[model samples]
Target: PEQAEVREIPAYIIRLQDEDIVAYSRVCPKGCRYLNYIPEPRKCSHCNTQRGRDLCCCGFAVDNPVLKCPKCWSIFDLARKGQILCGRAPRPPVEFKLDLDGESIVIASLQERIW
Candidate 1:
């Protein structure tokens, strides 16, 4: 999914593999750079293991990429607890719980802390 905003904050709404829907702050805490939604066959997942076709640094040529950290080469796999896979970030992504309205997802409150 592309970057969308919640209450003007950069965020993304992701539908997990299990069909569960959730939201996360797309802003990287390391430098506040927007995280790229890079799918698998990724360039890399961390600093030491380079397994994918391209390095996580390459922001080009990726189709449906997972959330990747361009500044510190960190990658986030949505299937997990949305942890900071690598790099210098001290915490995981901030999660925002969504509510199901009449055929819509709604954000009804403001959260100032990281989940």
Candidate 2:
């Protein structure tokens, strides 16, 4: 589905092609650092030889969007909801159930979270 991002909410929002919207928490479970929505990892010349866990091949696989932890280098798949798509580090940013009301998206409930 085509991805259209809407930042009206404080969280990461992805507007689907089907007119449905989904949101995810932006807190990193590893170190409680704020997570950012990265559409794709920037592949630079030096990223290939980087020794620290900053960037890697899995970071390149993020085609749509993924939540990335700046501290522990953890990555969470938006589609998988708190599950580590590549690296294992999720304080378990949960999926909040939303209720759409015209132009507003309301938080209906929160998904059960786990570390």
Candidate 3:
């Protein structure tokens, strides 16, 4: 049987939400096209210690709603398999970052801001 042509969507555009919690796609500091969003503060996957929580595309801590993964360099989604191909080889493992800033702030109010 012929394989069906699958349409591809930007992983960074994926929306992850929970009861009162939501996350958007934040650009990877590494400059990868992939972005991630979590509901709390987290360390960067590349730097392993750098925090990009609630930061904007400028990489600053603001009332931003988009966040990205530090490792796989992917925007955490129900579709992510924890393994992403960058150029050719797979990327290293890393934790995801979340955006939490204020109350009723869909840009940050991810239930509770993670530092």
Q: By lDDT, who's the top model here?
A: 2
- Best model per TM-score: 2
lDDT of 1 by residue, 1-115 (tens): 2343345657777776667776777887577588876555244344344454345443333333357666776655566656555567766566677787776777655345643
Clashing pairs in 1: 37-65, 38-65, 38-66, 39-64, 39-65, 39-66, 43-54
**Which runs in model 2 stand beyond 4 Å of their true positions?**
1-10, 16-20, 42-54, 57-60, 88-91
lDDT (0 to 1) per candidate: 0.60, 0.62, 0.34
* Residue-pair clashes, model 3: 5
lDDT of 3 by residue, 89-109 (tens): 233223333343342222322
Residue pairs with colliding backbones in model 2 are 29-91
lDDT of 2 by residue, 14-105 (tens): 66434457777776666556887765555423266656335553435544556777666676766555457655573557678888667566
How many clashes in each structure?
7, 1, 5
Q: How far in Å is the alpha carbon of 10 misplaced in model 2?
A: 5.2
Off by over 4 Å in 1: 1-9, 41-65, 109-115
Lowest summed lDDT across 10 adjacent residues in model 2 is found at: 1-10
Who is ahead in lDDT, 2 or 3? 2
Report residue 90 deviation for candidate 1 (angstroms).
Answer: 1.2
